[model samples]
Target: MDELEFMRGRVYGADHDDAAPRPGRVYAELVGGPLDGLLLDVTDRTERELRGGVVLPTEIGRHGPGGGAVYAPRGPGDRRFDWRGDVP
Candidate 1:
């Protein structure tokens, strides 16, 4: 199967220098952009893990600098990502 198939349309975008990726959340780097692309499942991701925030995988791996940030709750009053079905 192709890589896209593995993503199952859960692919997300992220600049390798995007400061930081929220913990519990996933990010996808762009093919040509400075990012390396990330993937996440908001619906299934645990809320507790997000509380501490997260650095992008690349950053966590030391491939780059800081990335993850304080993971804000996606509650009704908090900032939440709007899924457009485009994945990222």
Candidate 2:
């Protein structure tokens, strides 16, 4: 399924217990940057965070543009994916 599809039709419970970074953010950063993925608006978060997290656009699954709020703080500023290039 696409990112949008995965995110659609339901609300993901914010899980703060997991210290791992948001997977959606990683995918966004990769797809929306030098990684060859479509670029996304930094303001567009990924999803609901349990403790303190980010949210990205839900439509990001298909790799189109904007679809819905996603809550993503790990995009570029979070410093999750480097080596490729400075995110922000």
Candidate 3:
């Protein structure tokens, strides 16, 4: 499997044996920062949610549990989210 396929299993869990995206489930690749290369499951998120971005907790982040990694979609048509930075 390729890097993304490997990450899909790692991020979504081992039970997800299939590399192909599941129907109705939206996924975006995280670019840069602590969560780089990880897939964010935005399946149930709305367009506003995607545009406003999200804060995800990560052990590798600068502030650990006190802060989170900020990620926002590059654009409406982009499938990758760029890391804005860490938030406290």
The best candidate by TM-score is: 3
- Give residue 45's lDDT in candidate 2 (0 to 100): 44
Q: On lDDT, who's better, 2 or 3?
A: 3
TM-score of each: 0.27, 0.19, 0.73
Off by over 4 Å in 1: 1-10, 13-40, 59-88
In model 3, where is the ten-residue run with the lowest total lDDT?
8-17
lDDT score, residue 6, model 3? 58
Candidate 1 C-alpha lDDT tens digits along 24-43: 65443232122223343344
The deviation in Å at residue 64 for candidate 3 is 1.8
Report the lDDT tens digits of candidate 2 across residue range 1-88: 8754443322233342542335454332322322222333223443433114334444333444543333333443462322222211
Q: What is the model-wide C-alpha lDDT for candidate 2?
A: 0.34
Q: State candidate 3's TM-score.
A: 0.73
Better of 1 and 3 by lDDT: 3
Error of 3 at 39 (Å): 0.4
- What is the RMSD, in Å, between candidate 1 and the native fold over all Cα? 11.4
